[model samples]
Target chain A: MTDLIERPSTEAVPGHGAPTHGDDDHAHGGDHEHHGPSGILKWLTSTDHKVIGINYTVTSIVMMVIGGAFAEVIRAQLVSPTNTLVTFQQYNQLFTMHGSVMIYLFVGPFAFAGLANYLVPLQVGAPDMAFPRLNALSYWLYLSGSITMLLGFFVTGGPAAFGWVGYAPLTSAINAPGAGPDLWIGALMLTGFSAIFSGVNLIATIFYLRAPGMTLFRMPIFTWNMLVTGILILLAFPVLTAGLVMLYCDRHFGTHIFEVQGGGVPLLWQHIFWFWGHPEVYILALPFFGMVTEVIPTFSRKPLFGYKGMVFATLTIAALSLGVWAHHMFTTGAVLLPFFSIMSLLIAVPTGIKIFNWIGTMWGGNLVFSTAMLMAIGFVVTFLIGGITGIYLASPPLDFFTHDTYFVIAHFHSVVMALTLGAFAGIYFWFPKITGKMLHEGWGKAQFWLLFIGTQVFTVPLYIVGLHGMPRRMAVYPNNPSWQNLNEWSSVGALMIGISTLLFVVNVIQAYRKPIPAGDNPWDASTLEWFTSSPPPHHNFVSLPPIRSERPVWDYNHPDAPALAHGHHETATPPAAPAEQEAHA
Target chain B: MKQESVILLLLGVFFGFIGVVYWGWGHEDGGGIMLLGAFLLGMLPGFYYLWWYRKSGGNRPEDRDDATVADGAGVVDAFPSTSIWPFVLGSGCFFIVLALTFGTWLLVPGVGLLLSALIGATAESRRGGNV
Candidate 1:
């Protein structure tokens, strides 16, 4: 690696001669890596981060559709008291697959593997990830894991139906006794290993590959969130892998780590699972939080408020999250209840700080209500509700009462809603940069409203019925008009949610079909990504803008902006050299 | 070495402090040991970055306040061309997974593909061509 870098393989463009950075010895960017095979072979064998990112993303979208299909079927079964849309056994499999596919394959990978793979190197001005081939391997491994999981349905006894948690002796060989649960375990182990490697790749990129003058603090908030997310993945995934290994041994190798008959403790499973599970929540969230941070500043036409505070707050939230896993186990009675509860409640402090930071960025600014911006606003509102409910659930008494009820379902769904909206905002915001084509703004808004309203319609009744003592994972129920009516409304909302995703599918197709080319910097965004060409060239940059502050692109464009005018650089302490000043001017 | 180490150190301290407290009070050695393991996990990486920072003398262009953008410009590493090693590795992992569903006899080919992929990838990286 050092030999290749020190070799200085500089190549020149034919006619486009721009000032290529400071030293003439430097290699030109964006002039290499156009050689290789084409078509499907290219996609499978390519080492390009952007191609791998698109692979991760497109595959995740398909998985989401699959998970959502499971959801729709499950909802149809629950829509009426006497409905037999699916057998109880089928319902078990449906919800099981739904939760597994959505959490593992869809949300977490969409951010950690998909968007991060595409954006990190571009935003950092690096030629590629620190380990390009390893990056390719991570994507393929992820695909294999996804395929293994989906193949469970075709196995002899149907897919694993012990819920996504795959809790305890219920998942042991004595009970499950088939290849389905074993396949699920194997699939999860593969995915978990894939995530661990991705963490190594991303963290190395951020640490070793920043452009000149882009200090750790000068890196954008999106990259910062990704950095923290990378660490959490490293810290959390290995434990999950360990637990899965123990369970796999119990099932296949006759080890009795989780079998009650062998004097194994079942609660140990909860301890191991939630240890990874709680941190997994932040793994899914922090990247979307990064998205919201990016979008609000761009559309509000202001800098992110408390940039340093947001960074520290992200760290604080992660550290607190690692200690709060027992909050999920308060109903189980085998945890240090007070310690975990207090730690769980303490996460609210940093999260609340983040909320205020978004609102502060939008306050008194020229806020543009674009589809992306509207989604950011929507994220703030919905995520706040999720946060409040989370606080309620942190208390042992409340959590004990709401442990398996729709109330807990409503709370988490609100959070998923917020992050999904945040992801939608990121997609619309960066679609231009990814494909060099503008998504239809009208259709984008149409989809956003459908999703937002659908979430409320679906979850509000869930909270109401949960308060009225409705439980979750109940495939059949006695006829009661009130619960029946509320569930019907929720079912309608589920249909609306399904329609919205389909609309998004249509919007993506139309955008590609009748292409409206979006010029670079369509939103006049502050981040480094906006400084590059749309659907950036293979190596991602021609020449990077001079980095003097967190908002390097903004500093380069608005030379007289107050932030730069007052000399607010995070990296350099000395006054700018004359040529440097002249160049920036 | 850098601010990241400091961040990791802070996490380690938080986990380590709670770990001692939990063991002192809770009396169940299992959970406390897990907390200690977490502390060690955070600290090991923290110390590694710190070590690299010191060994490199902490004079990286990124750390230089007055460094020009071009000082950091260049191809950071050689991005290799297309190869089938990742695909080979994937198939190896897939077969290992399948070995669980089918009989244990499949482990032979599964482990075989995995070892071949490892050796093949190492050779491919050191030399040129598919090997």
Candidate 2:
């Protein structure tokens, strides 16, 4: 069964995708090895995708550390029910900044600006993103936007403490008067444009820049997910910017957008926020879904069991996500409960399909259980729980009971933890590709276990407490035996997550110190990225591999790799040279 | 008939049907209209991609079902080597954000930096970026 893909054929033909550019079309195209500008200046001004990717990764790592530090401090304050390690205001600031930093600054940049930046171009066999300079601009804007949001801390009023959601009236001038909210608004606008532009750049790159035969179907699932994610970002982020603008006006210009006294409905804020907010959840998860999809198939030594299904699931998820934002607002009495609850429940169908798809990919195959695969499998186990809780919460009846409770906390955090696991999988899977150095497998597995265990430890207790009527975002809880005990337990889990992250950092250091040179295609994987050297050069591929299937590298290696040979119905050869065309004429 | 349209158009029809259902049954709600908006959002892009998927007629070689590794071979584009405009642009954006804090006075430098960055970028693009 493992040796089936070895049928043989040498065929060069254009099928349906690549547009012909007349006679001798392939003879003159823009192919240049633009490896220029070294040193800090190279980083500062470079339009290279690799450099921009590194910029995003390094910055996200820094933000993650800062964000994680905030979480640790929050946990310390929660260690005892009566603990006041921070003032109430300070705790709000800590949690607000932590959530903001992680969501807007860390996870997004890590996944898109970082991982997608590094991989998508290579995966699609493109030289670089379609708009190189715009891509660089996005990085700069994102970097500066990240700084702007953090600058809220230095302001006179302290950081924005109305929660990362920044629900209005609470954020209005009367209730919350501060430059910190203003700064948060400004940072969001900046980052919003950064995200919007990044979305545009990525979508264009995927559409326009594929190598000659890399058809839509043949493109890797990772690239397909990026394309879908790009569309979601393009559609969703602008609403956030619009919402932020309105919030700013309500604060500074004395507008009545969210001010109930001015005949403005404050619930408008929830509507606008969640409209983007729910889709934002998918934006966060989809790329990690792509990453785990890639990792599982590679380690399992199988083509993704339902490749097209995964792609369709991604699109279906994106579309359904847009309609389900009101699920977040079910208890507000402002939304159509039946419509939203149904949409929310409907979304789970596609999401559930993806779960089955991943499982099927690994079912009968030789599984490697590498750290990357471990994290992918970890994602399958963990996110399934998260998804189930989602169904429970989607019902308006249940949500009315659980609104703002730790159940809410457990539900979202479970999803976030699962995605975090997926992200770690991606980082480990591609670290070798990015740095050309293999992280120690032993340490990688250790990190995965700590995170996986820590996630369960931290979130499982929250579920129990949540079901038992514990609340979220609380600075102080009455010293009840049940709540305090569980809260103490969860803080220990948070510490474990912190330790796992530290282990990851140490793993990187050890890899660099010992220097395990990961050759091109370290996993014997089957994508175009592996076709080039680890840490691919200024130009990604030096030579061509006939991209007849999704697993081009595998096909290239095995020539007639089984049923793949029979599938090559491509009959139209590439456009002839002018001389050959004249001869034919 | 394209795969993207199948998924996207299905979404559009769902939203459209739900929008109509919502408006008919839940007339006083903003969500009914929003569902209509969702239908538009889904269909407009859905139709556009479907149209382009049809119109472009030629996809990148990778779009083909049977395309081989050789079919994808080509000279790649010359990616830009360096551009100072991003720094200029970022700085301009920074000033713009600062203006929100300090007052309208900061917009002077911000707008100026932005305009210059725009000019520099336009010039750089026109020069083919080798300069």
Candidate 3:
């Protein structure tokens, strides 16, 4: 294993004219393996991060479709009062699967693992991830975990319908007696391990594998955010792992951890799960935060404002995220109010700072409202609403009123849905770089607006419905006069969101059908990734261009201080690197 | 003290720290935390070697393929031709996932895909074809 990288081997440098040395072997970014699929075996044995990224993406998309279909079923069931398009069992399963897939299986993994798989090494100027084989293992584990979950749908009694949270007493052996909850527990455990492994690999890579002269301050904001996110995962995932193990023991081995009659505390499950769970909210949102940070600067044609502050803010969020886990449990009545409220409210500070930084980044620059920017900007709006609403939820007084009401659903779904949209904006923005094929812009914008309007139309009304006393996750409600109009409007919004997603699928398929050229730097972004070829070569860099700032590629392109060295040595600080001057200026 | 070995060792150490923190401090159930921490101690060299590589030298393109050799010495060839193992592993992944998602019929194909890819790709790599 030491020989894998410790001992150097002889080979001719591909593009560069120089004869290489042992140190260069580890540094040279090139294909150590097949770049694209050549044969059946190559496809299977592939360890390439890019290939794995695509796989994560494709799998998540399929899951998205399945999840969306479930949402559609939910909507269809609620189109009118007392309508039973599906049985209650089916309804429960549908919502359970929908939430589970969207959060655990689809969104977080797709963004973190998928985006990190594709970009993290590139951003940090590494040839590949620190642990490439482990990277492959993470993907495999995730697939298996997802499979274990989907298999429960085919079970005799049906899948776990206790909701994605799997709150106990409900999920305990007695209330939901079956293999259904077992599958959910087991499958999620598998996925959880996969996430932890990927997080560790990514963190190690960023920490250890940076190119020469790429200091911590010189790293891109996206990379910085990922680094913090990685730490959060390291801290957050193990607890979830412990919680799941306990849950599994409780369900299968007759352990009375959450069994109320057996001297178990039901709230313990909430505490344990939310320990991992609340950070997960940021785990999901922070990547989107990174995405918007990348988008606003690139499209606005300005250096990201408050670069160091942004990094600090991101880290602050990760740190503060741990304290706020109890916010999710306020409605349970078991939470310690002042402690939970303070933690929750403190979260708003960093979050608010991030939004300010983003707006500041876009204040005055050559704003190119590309489809990516549009979605990013949209994320700013939607997330602000989500965050503002989050403030209300933080107060125990307000939460008491909103608890289990449509308002809580409205608040959370806005964050989840909008953050996802932000991620999609990032995907569409970077899709070209990853695929070396341009995604259709018109269609991309089309998908964005449809989703944007759809989410607003659907989620906003839920607030009114909640205030009117409509409970969430419930299939049937009496058609009270005030509730009548809001539910209909909400259903209408759900359809729009659905249609928008359909458009997105169509756009992705069409973009793939006809490849369009996305040159090495489509957005002219300053990050290290833009320095490489679109669909970067198997080994990412032939030359680690003299990096004076985090945006080494940007320096390379600028005429006055063009990137100096294109080989193994780091370039000395240039006369006036924009990253340095702009950061200070 | 090649950078690569140092990195591997360093990784082992970091994992050890994580093991202690997560297993030891983080959990109330400390049953396996110590053992897991001990196991993580094994990954130290890998981390150390990785660190050494980044620290010991500058980025010289001329030395890019020299990774398999000792720093500034030896004739070990590091830049072996592209291995297909990861791809095969991924395909095996596809099949396994397929089998899980679709059913047992898919399992046969999945296993076939996984086995053939792993065996063929790995066997060939060990035979020194890419190098």
Candidate 4:
């Protein structure tokens, strides 16, 4: 059978799905190097997007464990009244590295690199990523950047404790001097470059690539989300790279880019950082948005609700997310409250559309409560709460009370942590397809519940303590009876979140230990990705299948519907009729 | 012969234009910009020709000319048997990551992997006498 499959002349295979000009125009175009070794060699040297995707997932999981450990240490220190478990310096380092690692090292890269690596080419109907060698380089650069930043901890004076934002003066050599911030800046600069190059590659691929009849309008929601995400990276990362360069200059050289004593503007740093930082927020979340599009449609057993609107909303969010960066600096006292407030509130308009669309998608559908769906739903609820509190933070009046408090922590953590959960949800959902094996479902679900409850318990009370004038990044609250109880509750919640993380780890290990065979289209997804074998071939498709709609695989697998008018049809039978009938009926 | 080289040439021209704009800004430290510009100017037409042959509706024989693959090179499509360059590159990456994190000792292995891969690739490709 395999030989029969391989017997077709290469000329017979249709190439990229560009609008077929004539009979002779559709011969296969791409030529890639194929290598051997079924086991370790495949993983070690493979340029296949699927292999690269697994590498991303494995690396991200490792970082998450490391990030979560940092969280636990922070929680343990905060559990009791005035517990000097860790020194003040140590506590500062913990939260700062925790924030930086989780944001840059874990969520940001994992969301884009992991899902985009696996899904972008499949969604766009390409054989593989546009630049396969470049794709490998992105992964390597990311791993390199992550390791460099982490290595800062082992260096003298520990990692930069100036918070992930690395606010000036605090990060400046005059106030807090060390090799720590240098490592942080250098690592981020490297990671930023990785993201920029990958973004360029993805953008060029999606635009120039795609199978025939796969019009922009007909593209899947996940692909659209990534398209917008790629644009965001191009625009946002350069500003960050510039900012990092200026920062490097200030730190290493005697440049006064942000040096207060040297007549440098601290707020300039804020402008540049947040310009990238705010978009960084969406860069982190948009992939989750993309994943939600995938999960919600599959679990709800419907095509995405308002697909075009969701795409528009995603772009809107990406654009608006850029303008609202200053809202993060409301506490900095130099920002214009009215302008930032308006922009921040305006963001909710597009965001509201997204929430409604997700809910609309699930409404009156089968609504399978898989680990993926739970996480998507979790994203909506958590992000909604995060968004609402964000509006409060946007207001100068409300922010005056909550500024630098645990309230701010609760707000951002809700959004970013929700992103982490959503990413994990995607990893679990797609793990079977990518690995050609099933992750332990029982462990997966248990992990989900733990994180859900843990997030609520741990982060919600930070709001209360925040309102009671308790600041963030504080090692110990000195004799504040009012703050003690809520802090303890938060600690307990943190512990649960930690346990949930362990469950996920256990699930990953167990699944790898005895891999379950997941056949092609395990979820019965309608998109083109599911049409191929589990862990798709290095060159994605063999014969370019005829795609008439967004859901080509579904169209093909359905038995009832007539085949679309496409030349170079390989299979004699119309295999898609049954699924089409079932869907319509 | 491949599309990538042509694309790179086109990129060179476009980037050269950018270098021109930077040079016009009269920044004295524009040597880097001008050098990049010179490189790009030298590469444009060659790239344009290559892209025309591969992608554009070109006047060429069907069999002898490069035949464009379908949307994806569909399932079971054959190509050159796998090469070891990617693994060598991966090894280079592992060492680079280690060197970044641990110390300079790891840099030696990374450089070694990279050089060996480069040399090995160059030698093997030359065996086909393509280069």
Candidate 5:
């Protein structure tokens, strides 16, 4: 059978045709070079994709801590309807910074830029990103942008109290007369540039850097999702960047782009922001969908039920995401209600297709309920609730009622929370692969349950209170004594989430303390990533098996029954088994 | 690739049909136009990839199963040995933003540093033989 597989060409593959460099050769060393930079300088100056990825991941985690702290402050303020924890102004800053930090700094960077950076190359069987230095530049810019945004805290009038959206009239020089909004504008512009660079790099890498036989159709679902995500960033972030420039000009040069009194429409800001904002939701989401896609197949021990369907569904979602932006403006009255409403509802079809495909993948398969799988399943349940409620808000009439209420808050949290859950799942699933050590499964499972319960406890009440007409971003509300109970419950849930996060930290610490080496393929997975060692070598794969299908390793392990056996052309002569190849060397 | 393109083309048509419903209902607003635009955009990749696949002999390295990792191994991507342009560029940007609040004096150095950094980064990559 091996000889049959090797009957094609004896010549080396065209793409992987370069001579192997000595391990110590810095000039052309493989990714797993024995001698590389060490210490802080190594992290700061390195262009290695893996190093940059770790930097991004660590930086985003720190930002999450900062953002979560702000959430706690907001929760504390709202615990008792009358402001006790913070003054009204402080409360405004708290919520505004919380939203901004979470959206811009934490989730977007963590998933698309950070996790994608680490795994995409390994999964695609590439050495590094197309532009490694630019990759480093993106991370630095992200870090600087995050710091610049947070610098607003030290300014005279607190950080951009007009909220994360920073609507024009409210954010005007006269309305928000401080350096804070300027800082917000500057921070956004910087981060926007960083995202654009990262997007371009990822798109280029995915398009040009696949291994010998990995084609567009054969790429992992996670890599495909990131590819779409990179496109979204390329298209969407620039609009926001333009908006930020306009906002800055309005604040300084007296430009009237969004100033209604100056003949600039305030709704212009809404149009611009949500144009980016709606797609931004998917920018944070599509990766989660991809992560879940990867997790579902592995744990269920089945080939992904509909690979082509999943890919098309992802593309469909991306294309329609642009059209559904105005659905967010349904209650604004200026938006064309019927048109936006229909588009909003229509976007759900692709999403629904994805959900069904996941269930289909799991149906009647041997399910391994790892912590990662548990979180993936949790995402399905929570995201479904979020999606169903979203349909309610898609209706103009319903939106008018629920607009600016806790119900909207609940709905947004449900979806973003689902994405966050999915990020955790990806982190857990790949932790061993990245670190060469398995996480404490018992603690990981405990963390999942806590977070799962905590999220429901935290946000579900926001729905109840929102339906009861409790407005969002309010420091205190009068004539709503009954709202206090739900608020307290929500705060408790927030605390639980915090605890769950701490447990995750504990799990990481414990895993690292007593490192048990995870071999090359601990999970017996199917992808190219598992074909290499845990924490893959500098140049990712030393040798790869025949890429017969999407599941290369699976094909290698089960040579008799390859996945998708149609049109199995022999591109190159099969090499010895990975272990055998190493032994021969 | 051809089959995947077909799937996307059909999905595009389905979305296009949804857009027609909106258009025929006399709802010719931005929302209706956007729906149509989305469906049209969705069909583009389908058309392009289909064309490329057919033109380029409908088969790619990914289509085969007999290649090994050694077949995939080669020169890992070229990376800069070391460079300071990122820091330079980042500092320039930081100062430029800071100059927004502090003083215009910072802008001159910021722009100067930015230009130098851009040139240096490009030159460094070329010099390092990575590009």
Candidate 6:
């Protein structure tokens, strides 16, 4: 193992030229295996971070559709006050599985692991992750876990129906008998391992693999977010892993950890789960914050406003997120309500600082409302609304009324929905760089509008009905008749979101079929990623510009007015000749 | 990095002050403990970064604006070419989890696969095999 760690193999310098190292028999010193491996095996055994990233993205999309299908069934059942669409058992399974798949499989993995895997290495100007083999292992573990979780649907008693939270006593063996919840527990444990592995890999890569000139302060905002996210995952995931193990032991080994009759405390599960759960919320959303941070600066054609403030705000949010987890347990009566309430409210301050920084970034710049920028701006608006609504819930007195109601549903859904928008914005902005193909702007805009308008239409009524005393997760509601209209309106909104998602699928397909090459730096952005080729080669870059500031390319473009000049270590080597400059350009 | 550390340290102090105020006001149960936790957590990264900044002479490559892509050209970073251990490890985990439902007997192979996968992933590159 030490020998493997110390192996002196040839490294490939891609993008500039072909294999220059003559010692190795393998093409590109085995680093460029993506060029060699073909067909399905390439995808399965390939250790390439890019391939694993693509695999994660595709799988998460499919999971999103499956989760969305479950959601549609939920909406269909709730279209009217009567329970005509499905029985209570089936409805319970639908909502539970929907929430589980969307949170664990789709949103969290897609944003943190999937997108981060692809972009982080590129953004940091590294050939691959610090641990490529471990990267592959993480992806495979995620797939295995996702598959295991989904397999519960085929079980005799159906999938776990104890809510996505999987609160205990309810999820204990005596109460929820079957392989369904067991599979859920097992799946969560596996995915928990996957997340921890990815977290370690990302933190290592970002910390150690940065280019020579890319300092900690100069790292991209997206990379900063990923860094903090990696820390949060490392800190928080173990609690969930422990919780899953305890639950598994309770279910299979009869340890009765949550069995109140057996001297167990059900609230223990809540404490453990929410300890990870609230951070998991930020885990899912912080990447989007990073995405918006990138998009706003690029389209606004300005360096990020309060760059130092944004970084500190992100770190602050991460730290505060840990202490505020009990906010979710505000109504449980077992929690210290005042402590949780104040912490929850205080966490909002750093988040508000971030929003202000974003708006300040766009305040006095050439703001271009491209599809990506529009989605990002949309994220800012919707996420702010979500954040504000959250503050209302932070008050324990207010939470008492809103707990388990559609109001609670409205708050989180708004945040996650905004996250979805930000994810879409990131996809649009980076699609050109990833695939070297630009999506059709008209179709992209159409899809965005449909989603934006539809999301509002869908969630606004939910808030209204919730305020009107409608409870969530109900298979059927009372024949209040007035609640029926709002529910139906929300159902219509769900349909629009569905249609818009399909349009997005079509847009991706259509764009891929007719490829238009997006030149390097199509957006002329300032980040290191823009300095490389669109659809960068195996090793990502041939040569990187001297990173003197956060935006190296910006400095390259404006040599006279460089962003920062102090502390730059100028090598004795002469500047590039005019001809060389032209060639590089 | 120093600037960020200072800002975070200040924020930590502010939150700590809030905790003290809350405690004084007799809302100390959840509020004071949580606020204090937040303050301590905040100070952790702040001090860590401050240490790093001092240790590294406060110089960062990202702080240089005169660099170009050509300056970055060199031997690319090393990466493993191909390996089957990740697959083995994933399958091992899947089976181990699956064994919870089917039978405990599958755990033997699961453990075997896991151990072997770990060995393979760690030692493959040593033999000049795929990375």
DockQ of each: 0.47, 0.39, 0.11, 0.10, 0.26, 0.28
Tens digits of per-residue lDDT for model 6, A1-585: 111112113223322333222223432322321345578878777776777888888899899999999988999999888867899989988999999999999998898888899899888877777888888899889999999999998989989998999988889888889989988988898889999988988887886677766767788899999988997887679878988888888887878788887788788788788878988999998999998898888877767888878888888888777767778887777667777788799888889999998998788677767788889988998898899999999999889988889998988889988998998999988888888777777788898899888888889999999999999889999998789999999989889989989999998898789766666666767787776666766656544555667877766655555345333322122222223113222
Q: For model 4, what is the C-alpha lDDT against the true structure? A: 0.70
Error of 4 at A124 (Å): 1.8
- Per residue, candidate 4 scores C-alpha lDDT tens digits across A1-585 of 001112112322223322221122322333322335578666655556666766876787788889889999998888886898899999989998898888888887787887788888877666566655556667777787787788887888888888989888787776667767777876887678778877877776676566655666567777877877886787678777888888878876799988877899877777778877888889988888888778887777666677778867886787567556678777777665666687688888988998998888787766667777788888788888888998888788898889888999999988987887788778866876687777766777788888888898988999888888888888988677768888889989989988988888788788789777766766667787776666766556544445666666656555354443322122223223223223212
- Pitting candidate 1 against candidate 5, the one with the higher TM-score is 1
- Candidate 1 Cα deviation (angstroms), residue A196: 0.4
Best by DockQ, which number?
1
List candidate 6 stretches off by more than 4 Å: A1-34, A560-585, B1-77, B128-131
Winning candidate number (TM-score): 1
In candidate 5, stretches whose alpha carbon ends up further than 4 angstroms from where it belongs are A1-34, A560-562, A565-585, B1-77
lDDT of each: 0.82, 0.80, 0.70, 0.70, 0.78, 0.79
Poorest lDDT segment (10 consecutive residues) of candidate 4 chain A: A1-10
Count of backbone clashes, every candidate in sequence: 1, 26, 76, 31, 14, 21
Please report how far candidate 6 places residue A159 from its true position, in Å: 0.4
Once fitted onto the true fold, the runs of candidate 2 whose alpha carbons sit more than 4 angstroms away are: A1-35, A565-585, B1-15, B28-38, B45-60, B66-78, B129-131
Question: Model 1: DockQ against the native?
Answer: 0.47
lDDT of 3: 0.70
What clash count does candidate 4 reach? Answer: 31
Candidate 4 Cα outliers beyond 4 Å, as residue runs = A1-34, A37-44, A559-585, B1-131
Off by over 4 Å in 3: A1-39, A561-585, B1-131
What TM-score does each of the candidates earn?
0.93, 0.90, 0.80, 0.79, 0.88, 0.87
